[model samples]
Target chain A: MSALRIALFLILFSFALANENPDAHVFPRPLVIEYPENIEPRFDDEVRLKCASWRFAGEANNLNPWKTIPEECAGYVKDYMTGKGYESDLLRASEEAGVYAQNVELGGDGKDVWVFDVDETLISNLPYYYEHGFGLEVFDSVEFDKWVEKGVAPAIKSSLKLYQDIKRLGFKAFLLTGRSDRHREVTVENLKNAGFQDWDKLVLRLPEDHVKSATTYKSEKRSQMVEEGFRIVGNSGDQWSDLLGSSMSQRSFKLPNPMYFIP
Target chain B: MSALRIALFLILFSFALANENPDAHVFPRPLVIEYPENIEPRFDDEVRLKCASWRFAGEANNLNPWKTIPEECAGYVKDYMTGKGYESDLLRASEEAGVYAQNVELGGDGKDVWVFDVDETLISNLPYYYEHGFGLEVFDSVEFDKWVEKGVAPAIKSSLKLYQDIKRLGFKAFLLTGRSDRHREVTVENLKNAGFQDWDKLVLRLPEDHVKSATTYKSEKRSQMVEEGFRIVGNSGDQWSDLLGSSMSQRSFKLPNPMYFIP
Candidate 1:
């Protein structure tokens, strides 16, 4: 075939593949409702018909300027962390595991500090994924840095507020994410932009090691916190590895992550 | 030996066994966390802290009373479902799975419907587990029914609100849960007590079939919905199996289940 004809053929093939699924990375399959009717009705209950998916074009597709994440979810995040008697679990676990700091109070020499994963654990990153249509690809620090620079992805507002509340309450905060250290400048900028003003430390996942098992890398970081003489009062992450096997942070605080996971 | 001495010996023996680890139901050892920080990160990401050992306890734990759950996790249940857009990956998955009902303009027959699971999907059940101190030995549906009946457990309030919104927009609602069919009367009462005035249907799992995958039984129930010409918009469940391979429901809506999972 002529060179021009071959080029035309390739273009046609690409278009066909794209057209096969119109929404691109966004899957628009209809939801199924299949709960059965009660043969023996009993209690009065509130049922919700919820949509499970949102339109996410990945980091590539999000064209909307970054803004605060939805308020409804923000309230939910804040309430989840601060509400229940979860501290007791930490206390009990700490006592059992001998991970508790000697001084019960926070900020006592910052000897023991709690480290958190920033993206899913501390803030919401789904907008970046959905808006940009970026999925399954290695995170581009350059693009990520740019995204944070734009201040498009908001900290899970509630989590940020809770972190602030925790800081005010005396717990020291350290952030550790799977994000490469190369993006440290932008990540720090984003956190400050999102309202996390007083973190005791911020630990980005060193590309060579921290990104391996997010849980293990995070757990190892706790040792650093411990070495600093701070007993990790608590460790929080959207993933379990962030808190697994930490001798100091007996209690682990987990936030909800519906978007990306390292499991 | 004297009877008194014998009784003392027995008591000591029992204490030793009981104290070995009260949570006999828990699987052996802990899940992997912070593995060398440099291993390939599991890209799936939503792995729970208790990912590896999900068992009988994990599946049924949600049925416990809300107050029994840890306090810090109170709002997690509610937050999981109501969170939408790019902030939540699970919700994003639900959307991508094509579970959310859309284009109301396309609706014609009132018969088209969807079925959903309760617990983590619609009702926030984390408080029950967290407050109860991860009582692995306790699996009390009656207590849960009472709690639900009492209406103290908060609805994934956002999801509840969304459900109301969906119903108002004109889609019939149905519920399918692993809750025993025997408790149907109490379940209905609980729904009403929880402020679900218009729950159209409820289906509970058979006690015998609840052992393996509850999704199998749920999928069986989808036949009934299909017979009614209902295009199941989406399925909502905390476990993967609940939404597995049902023709009636084109998509599955999965909510975050931090406390436990059946897989």
Candidate 2:
């Protein structure tokens, strides 16, 4: 191709890309599916700001107990959850956790542990969230549990890498999740299928534990681990509830999750 | 203009905009200045993600105690601090705080107080930061005190409005800051000039507090407030140090301050 023709082609390609994403970044997000006809939501400046604001608040734990993603942010969440921004955010957290883990001088007692929050923190439930409206709809535990029964969630690659890296650094890996005892067998199978293994323990919710909030329950479990001589040196979770409250880790890394708020 | 002419104009305009901002959002950021010579940074996919990830971790309190912004992320931080993204993030937190305040049933005794951190919370030090490479340089107390001595720092408009709204809703605003007592006169002048008034108290560091960490000093002060019959119903600050620890508040709102970390 001539230099002039090549330049023209580049301009045309960029124009099409720009038309699709108003905040068009170098790392493009593939549309999950084309919006049908004029039903395509026009993400003007105001809506983008509003949605971005809500996400920021949620991450910082200022916003809570949202029933669903805001109506205006449905498309924004879709793009974010599927984009390089989300992947890069996850990578950032994982990278930091890796560095922090490497620096911590662990006791040779093998009781020093790292806690990993299962769902979005390890194996993403993106497929399930996609089937639902990318957090546009209210959460349904019964339906979500059924999806869990299928045990097919894929590994979040960066998180998996961090998990392995931290484990190799002489930290006992503990998978502390809110998933109940009933799903323990399937959870284990799914975790193994996702390339997660040698977790020192998979701590799941007992029948008596469901009444407490995620923070309280997780804190109690962590306290129990401490009683058994485990030191939680690093904790990573997508939800603040997973990382907050008493007996928390030495350092807590928060992964990106705009799809839903756990509490 | 004819339809075809208008179309041609838009294509050219968007092409120019796209060239400037890879993530060219509908909410445009005014460029601070043109980069001179070959120093104009090319924010490739990698740099954007790394800087963004660092930001995410910092907000969540997973990353801390860094002396300066990463050299590679200096431009990214500049763009973030001066951009609509930062402003919108502030607006979101302020809006949420307003709603929460309205819903709070205040005790009419004037003892239901809300704590506000001064720098980056009520008044901004953006002018100072802009001059210092947007947190790229190590924080220097002697120089920063010089900036505060001038008492010309601008009000963060959203936070000032939130202060007024919450105060009207019967919450007493207490400005708690890490600044030493020496800066009190100028800080007060700065506050009043910035349109802040009738605050219940302006709490600054004391001689004894000079040795204490921000988290420790603030937590002690908050505990003292509780002992004095004041109920801290809400707290807002730019740093996690201001919010974390005992006797925090009924609710705490975190404003964006990527320009610097206090602790």
Candidate 3:
């Protein structure tokens, strides 16, 4: 009994030491809670009003480079990324999309296509945003390009699941992104690494295909898909431009992306 | 010509004074910029992992009272509330609903019904939320009730437009809420004050009708509505419970709400 007790103690002590090991990097530093008294308010009424006005008007007028996402909007963005509300919404949408796909009778002519947007839809740029102050700073294309080249974006779990489920239901998955064709190789590597596999096609913007807006560019590509005898049954994107315009899919699902406005 | 210039200068001086007047409240205090150096890294890899886990598991397992909204989630909520993304989505949905309503041949029997949820859908509690910490603080029913009794919640602009448009299109509007029947009088008064007119019926939960879940209770009421010879053509709410279950309306629109989850 004494020998058994000693062995049990040794096992427990080793487990405790393993948990406390800093080399494992398992334990993160506690979140520092700054009291309201300690910190000045990041947003004022005027800034809040401006943010609201910008949100309402941005749809009609394209956003200019001079405008930056207000610091006050950071809280709203954080809630979408880490809160239950956003997860619940995405789950509901993906589940509905799955059901819609299941109910549709596919002709199985190998021309049934489902379109998906890349950023903030299938994969997240959240890590980059988090490190860079959540759009409080001006958008730098060079910095963003470097981040994309790293090819380390995490998959939006629900979307990735939906992709697989739709594919299993006999729909061809096509990745349609506004990313320039120059980064096609890196984008492909990122998508695959992020658990997206066996996509039918990956469409990106070509240098010669300079268009007025993302809506026109994407709509023309979708029209081309339709002209090729492909029936786009379902399309999912984070932007209105991806879902709107001619040759639209029968059903369009929009995932939330509030970080930036795309025309 | 010298006298005219003097007059112009005086007018410009007066205009500037008017703008600077505190009573006008036109200008707000500037937002204070807190450098990243001031903020300790609140979200590390472990924290990120934990946030992701909580998101996935919280739906099945109710979150603890101690768990506060993470800072990153603020962005998501803000996007839903004050970002162009949400406004654009709602406008698109309202337009689509209008087109659908217009195309359908109504019997002019007044049996066609359009359902709208009271809170977050029709009237917004944004003022109350803004005064508070936007759900960073725990919800206190007493405080919320007092705020509600003030009868000052502004109408959600897009929803108000939709309500008027659908009502003009000959669909009978019904306001359904999870608020108890005891507050019906106050709720009615609040709605009236908020510019909602001529809702055919307002449904609220009765004391005896308390069920295990909000979904079951709301679903049962909807079933009762269907039995009363009303064809629910459109139903809209912020919560999934409002749209789900038996006797669902032909179309359902969801407004964004990231503040709280109603079971």
Off by over 4 Å in 3: A1-67, B1-263
Off by over 4 Å in 1: A1-263, B1-105, B134-152
Alpha-carbon DockQ of candidate 3: 0.03
Q: Which candidate, 2 or 3, would have the higher TM-score against the true structure?
A: 2
Residue B205, model 3, lDDT: 86
Model 1 Cα lDDT, one tens digit per residue, B1-263? 45754453344223322333322311111111122424443322223222211211122221211223233332333233223311243334344333245543536678756576776666544445544334332457676665444333334433454466557767777897877777677666645544566867887877776775665677777877777677777566766556654453644455545445443
Error of 1 at B132 (Å): 2.8
For candidate 3, the C-alpha RMSD (Å) to the true structure equals 17.2
Better of 1 and 2 by TM-score: 2
Top candidate when judged by TM-score against the true structure: 2
Expressed as tens digits, the lDDT of each residue in A1-263 for candidate 3 is: 65753453344223323343323321111112122333444566555444533432332221332235657766544544444444454554566677778888998698898999999888777667766655667778899998787666666667877999989999999899998899999889778766789999999999966564788888999999999999999988877678767788877776645567666
Q: Per-residue lDDT tens digits of candidate 2, residues A157-201? A: 778789889878889998899999999998998787767889998
What is candidate 3's lDDT per residue for B64-158, written digit by digit as tens?
Answer: 22234556654344433443444454554555556667766776999999988999888767666765555566788899987776555655556
Tens-place lDDT per residue, model 2, B151-212, is 76666777778988987788888999999998899899878876788998899999999999
**lDDT (C-alpha) at residue A130 in model 3:** 66
True-contact fraction in model 2 equals 0.63
